[model samples]
Target: MINWLQHAPVYPIVVPLIAGAAMLLLADKHRILRASISVLAALAQLAAAITLLALAAGAGDIWPKGVGVYLLGDWAAPFGIVLAVDRLSAVMLTLTAVLGVASLFYSLARWDRLGVHFHSLFQFLLMGLNGAFLTGDLFNLFVFFEILLAASYGLILHGSGVARVSAGLQYIAVNLVASFLLLISIALIYGVTGTLNLADLAVRAGTLGGTDRLLFEIGAAVLGVAFLVKAGAWPMNFWLVRGYSSASAPVAAIFSIMTKVGIYALLRIGSLLLPTGAPAAFSLEWMFVIGMATLIFGAIGLLATQQLDQLVSYCVIVSAGTLLTALGMPGVRLTGPALFYLVSSVLTTGAFFMLVELVERTQTFGANVLAVTLDLFDLDDPESPNRSDDVVGVAIPAAMAFLGLAFVSCALLVTGLPPLSGFVAKFSLLSAAVAEANASMQPADAWILVAGVLVAGLAGIIAFGRAGMRIFWGNDERTTPRLRVLEAGPVSILLLLCVALAAGAGPVSAYLDAAARSLDDPSLYIDAVLSASPTRAIGGH
Candidate 1:
C-alpha cells in the first residue's frame, strides 16, 4: 500500500486514459454505461487530486519541501520522465477535476447524445489536461499539449452546426500553427541544452555560453508566442471568441480552463527555466503591453456585443489579460493575489458559460422582439401611458427569476462587485499592487494594471447589466424553459465552489503565498527534482 501510494502522481493521468479507452469499446447505444464510467472516472480523479494536494501540502513526511517527484520506470530525473507536483500543480489538478465533473454532469442533459464518442473525448481531454499540469519535462508537456488540442478539436465540433464547424476549423488551424512553433522551439532548446527535463534546464540555464544563450532566448521567444496565442493575449487571440462562442455550452465551459493551461505553461516555464535578473526577464515588457491591450480590447468587445455567449467569451479574454498583467509585474506579492484571482475568475467564467445557454433558451424570442421594438421606437416611451402590457409590471416567471438570480450572481462575481469572491480577489490584487508601489516609491506599471482591472470590471458590469435587463426584465412574455436537474446542478456546484473559495480565502491565500514564494525560488524545485534520484533519495537533500 505504501509503495502503491507513491505512484499516486500517475493515477490522475492514467485513470482517465484507461477510462476513455474503455469507453471507446462500448457502443454508442450504451450511453448509460459510458456516462457512468465517465462520472466515476472523474470522481476517482478528483479523489486522487485531493489526496495529492494534501500530500504536497505536507500532510506526511514524504516530501518536506512541499514537492513530490515521481520517476517513471524507476529511472532517475534529467533522463527519464518525471511528474512533479507542488502546490501549484496540485491546485491545477484539483481545478481540472472540478471542471471535469461539472462539464461531464452538464453534458448528461443533452450534449452526450448529440455526437458519437462524446464520453471518450471528454475523458481523453481530462487525461490530457491532467498530464499537462503534472508533467515535469518539456517533451511530455508538448505531447500533452497535442493530446488536449486533439481532444478539444472534437469537442468544439460536437454539435455539428455551421457556426461550430467553421469556428472549429479556424481553431484547429491556429493551434496547428502554434503546435508547429512549439516543436521548433523545443527542438532549438534541446539542441542548445541537450536535455528536455524542466529541472535540468533550470539547473543548466546559468551555464550557457553567449551563442547558446542567444539561441535559447530565441527559442523561448518562439515558445512564448505559441503560449500567448493559446492564452488569448492580444494580436494572437483572434480565434478565441468565435471558437468559444460557437462551441456548445458544456464544451465552452471546459474550454475556459484551456486558456489557463497556456498561462500555466508560461508561468511555470518562466519561473523555472529563467534565472533571476536582467538577462532572464526577456519579453516581459512585451507581455505587459500586449496584456494591457488585450484587457481593453476585451472590455470593448464585452460592451459592444449583444450575445451572452460572446460576452462570456470576452470575459475569458479579460480574465487572461488580468492574469498576464499581474504576472508580468516583478514580485511575489502581486503574483500571490493574481493566483487567487485566477481561481475566482475561471470559476465565474465557467458558470457564466453554462448559464448562457439555459438563459438563452427562454430569451430567444423575447430578444428578437426587443430588437425590433428598439429599432422602431427610439427613446420616446418613458412616460407613455399607453405602453403595451409586455412592458409594465409583469411578474417575473419562475424560470426567468431563477436565471436572473444566477445571472446576477455571475455578474457580481465577474465584475468584481461587492459580496462575492470576485470582489475579494480584485481587492486583494489591487491592494497588493498599491502596497508594492508605495514600498518601492516608483509606481512604474502598477498604475496601469490597476486602471486595466478597474476599467475591465466596469465593462463587465455594463455588459451584464445590459444583457440581464434584455433577458429578464425588458420582455414580459416569459416562458419557463424546462430546467433539468443535471444541468442546474453543475452550475450550482461551480458557483458554490466560488463561495467556498471566498469563505476560505485566508487559508487559500496563505497557501498561494507559499506557492508564489516557492515559485520565485526555483532552487527549491530544482533541488527537489534533481536530488530525487535513487542514490540521492537514500540521503535526502
Candidate 2:
C-alpha cells in the first residue's frame, strides 16, 4: 500500500486517460454507459485530487513534505517526463475535477448526444488538464497543452452550429499559433540552459547574465505573450466572447477553466523561474498593463452586450483581468487573495454559462430583438408598468423563480456584491492591496488596481441589471421554461459551492496562504524534485 501510495501524483492524469480510452472503444451508441463511466471517472478524479491536495498540505505523514515528484518509468528528472505535485498543482487539479463533475453530469441531459464521442472528448480534456498540472518538465508541459487543446477543439464545436464552427476555428487558429510560439520559446531556453526540467531551469535561471540572459528574457517575453493570448487578455479576447457564448452550456461551463489554465501556466513558470528576490523574467508592470486593458475592454463590452451569454463571457474577461492585475504585484501577499478570487469567479461563471441557456428558454427570440430595438431608440418597454403594482401580478412559476434566483446569485458573484464568495474575494484582494500599499508599493500602481477592481464591479452591476430586466421583467408574455433535474442540479451545486466557499473562507484562505508561502519559497520545490529517488538514472547512471 505504501509503495502504491507513492505514485499518487500520477493518478489524476492516468485515471482520465484510461477512462477516455475506454469510452472511445465503447461505441458512441452506448451513451448511458458512457455517461456512467464518465461520472465514475469524474468522481474518482475528484477523490484522487482531494487526497493529493491533503497530502500536499501535509495532512498525512506519508511523504508529506508538501512537494512530491514522480519520475516516469523510475527515471530521474532533466532526462524524462516527471510528474510533480505541490499545493498549487493539487489545488488546480481539485478545481478541474469539481468543474468536470459539474460539466459532465450536465451534459448527460443533452449536450453529449449532440455529437459523436463527446464522452471521450470530455474525458480527454480532463486527462489533458491533469497532465498539464502535474508535468514537471517543460517540454512535456507543451505536450500536455496540445493534448488539452485537441480535446477542446472537439468540445467547443460539439453542437456544430455555424457560429460554433466559426468561433471554434478561430480558437483553434489562435492556440496553434500560441503553441508554436511556446515551442520557439522552449527551444531558445533549452539552447541557452541545456535543460528542459522546470527545477533544473530554476537552478540555472540565476546563473545567466550576459547574452544568454538577453536571449532568455526574450524567450520569456514570447512565452508570457503566448499565455496572455490564451488567457483571453485584451486584443486576444476578440474571439473569446463569441466562442464561449456559442458553445453548448456544458462545454462553456468547462471552458470557464480553460483560460485559467493559461494563466496558471504563467503563474507556475514565473514563480518557479523568478521567485521572490530573483531576477525578473517578465515585467510585472507590463503584465499589469495587459490586465488593465483586458479589464477595461471587458467592462465596456459588458455594458454594450444585450445577450446574457455574452455578458457572462465578458465577466470571464473581467475575472481574468482581476487575476492578472493582482498577480502583477510583487511578493506572495496578494497572490493568496488572487487564488481565492480565481476559485470564486470560476465557479460562478461556470454556473452562469449553464444558467444562460436555461433562462433563454423562457424568453422569445422576438422579445430579445424588441428589447434591442427599444434600447436603440431609447424607448421604454410598453408592457412594463409605469408604477409599482401594490396589488398583485401574475404568479411566478417555479422554473422562472429558480432561474431568477440563480441569475441574481450569479450577478452578485460577478459584481462582487454581498452574501457570496465574490464579495469576500474582492474584499480580501482590496485588503491585501492596502496592506501592500502601506509597505513601499507605488501609489499609482496601487490606485490603478484599486480603481480597476471597483470599476469592474460597477460594470457587473450595470451589465447584470440590463440583462436581467430584458430577460425577466421586460418580457412578461413568454412561456414557462422547462428545467431538467440534471441541468438544474449542476448549476445549483456550483452556486452552492460558492456559498460554501463564503462560509469556509477562513480555512480556504489559510490553505491558499500556505500555497503562496510554498511558492514564495521555490527552493523547497526544487529540492524535492532533485532529491526524488529513481530506479535508474538517465543512461543508467
Every model's TM-score: 0.92, 0.92
lDDT of 2 by residue, 1-541 (tens): 2566677899988888998899888964475788899999999999999999998888767656799888888877777678999989999999999999999988776567666788888988998889988999888888988999999999998865477799889989989998999999899989988998999899887888889888888887788877888899988888799889988899999999999988888888888877522334355777778889898999999889888889999999999998988998888889999999999999999999999877876778734642443344333534443211211123334988899899999999999999999999999999898888888547677678889999989988988998888778888777686567878899999999999999999999999999999888888888989887785543333
Q: Supply the global lDDT for candidate 1.
A: 0.85
Model 2, residue 487: distance off in Å is: 0.4
Q: Note the clash tally of each candidate.
A: 0, 0
> Could you tell me the lDDT of residue 160 within candidate 1?
57
Q: Write the per-residue lDDT of candidate 1 for residues 1-541, one digit (tens) a residue.
A: 2576688999999999999999999986576889999999999999999998888889877778999999887678898899999999998899889988998899886667666798899999999999999999998999999999999999999865577899999999999999999999999989998999999987776788789988988887888888888899988998999999989889999998999999999899888865733233244667678789999999999989999899999999999999988888876788889899988988888898999878876766634543443334331256543232233222334755677778999999999998889999999999998888888766878988998999999999889898888877787775667677777778888998888988999999998888899989888889998888763457532
- True-vs-predicted CA distance for residue 362, candidate 1, Å: 0.6
Alpha carbon lDDT of residue 68, candidate 2?
80
